[model samples]
Target: MIGMFATSKAGHDKDTVYIIVQEDTEYVYLADGKYKDTEHPKKKNKKHIQIIKKESDDILKEKLIKKQPIYNEEIRKAIGGIVCQKQM
Candidate 1:
């Protein structure tokens, strides 16, 4: 789902967190806002990622669903919040 957070379950990026920017039947495009920014998202197998949040932050979820412009800083901030929560 758009704007959902996920962690890589397989591959070299295993355990790496990312935001789901786009998805199809087979693959999902992900971004960390660092190595994988919105403009150049990494495409990975849908089954290879573990979903973190399906009901995500309202702002980011709305923006992604509406196809509005979003910046890397925003993505990084959003993801940081989630990761922090998980660590706590």
Candidate 2:
């Protein structure tokens, strides 16, 4: 589920939105591009996050799917857009 947005449901980061950078059987690596960048994603249990099914930035999606090198700024901006849209 790379590139998908998920909100932490538990732990200290509860309510924080993160991008799914990678996933495994029991866990998903998340990044916000601010504190948790691609280079250092936060590992969390799949059950602890609520995934956002709605599609977000296409360019970010493409980059994540292609295993491309992405910058933190791009991720931040993309997430900012999503949050803004949700509030409107």
Candidate 3:
């Protein structure tokens, strides 16, 4: 489960932004503001979800790559600090 944050200029409402939730290695797009409980049918785990603003595939990929290390570190720390943890 990972949460991705992005900014999009093509939004209809200035106060609203799209959110993409990547759960179980699947990406789900949520474009109904930020408080709505959008349905993601393509998700596999249903539990692992991500939230991000809607954007082009290239932009999304760029953001994901930029934040991948950060997200990975967070996940490692969350999972008993085993994946990237250093032995002491």
Candidate 4:
């Protein structure tokens, strides 16, 4: 699958980047190297943003498999809230 990586420039001045796995539009957040969950206003919940300090490509691949779905759901819920806000 194609994966696109991008960074968020909103808060903490933290180096937050996310990979979008093309097959299912899954998102995996990486910060530092290992996997960690941090809170950000943009995230639907605290776990939506994860910190990965120095993970290898192989490790990312394995973690991505499980993290993708959870991230995707958080994104969906965040977007839904935005749409609902606009409607009202």
Cα lDDT over the full model 4: 0.37
Report the C-alpha displacement of residue 35, candidate 1, in angstroms.
Answer: 0.4
Regions of model 4 farther than 4 Å from truth? 1-5, 14-56, 67-88
- Write model 4 residue lDDT over 1-88, tens digit each, in one string: 2222334444673435544332323444332222332222223222344332422244444554554433444433433443354369
- RMSD in Å for all candidates: 1.1, 1.1, 14.0, 14.0
Report, for every candidate in turn, its global Cα lDDT versus the true structure. 0.90, 0.89, 0.33, 0.37
lDDT of 2 by residue, 1-88 (tens): 8889998999999988888988889999999999999999999999999998865578888988888999999889878877887789
| Angstrom error at residue 25, model 4 | 8.5
| Poorest lDDT segment (10 consecutive residues) of candidate 2 | 52-61
Residue-by-residue lDDT tens digits, candidate 3, 1-88: 2334332333343323333434334434432222333332122222333223323345434554454422332222232222123234
RMSD of 1: 1.1
Window of ten residues with lowest summed lDDT in model 4: 37-46
Best-matching candidate per TM-score: 1
Residue 7 displacement in candidate 2 (angstroms): 0.4
Candidate 2 residue spans exceeding 4 A from truth? none
What residue pairs are clashing in model 1?
none
When sorted by TM-score, best at the front, the candidate numbers are 1, 2, 3, 4
Supply candidate 2's per-residue lDDT for 70. Answer: 92
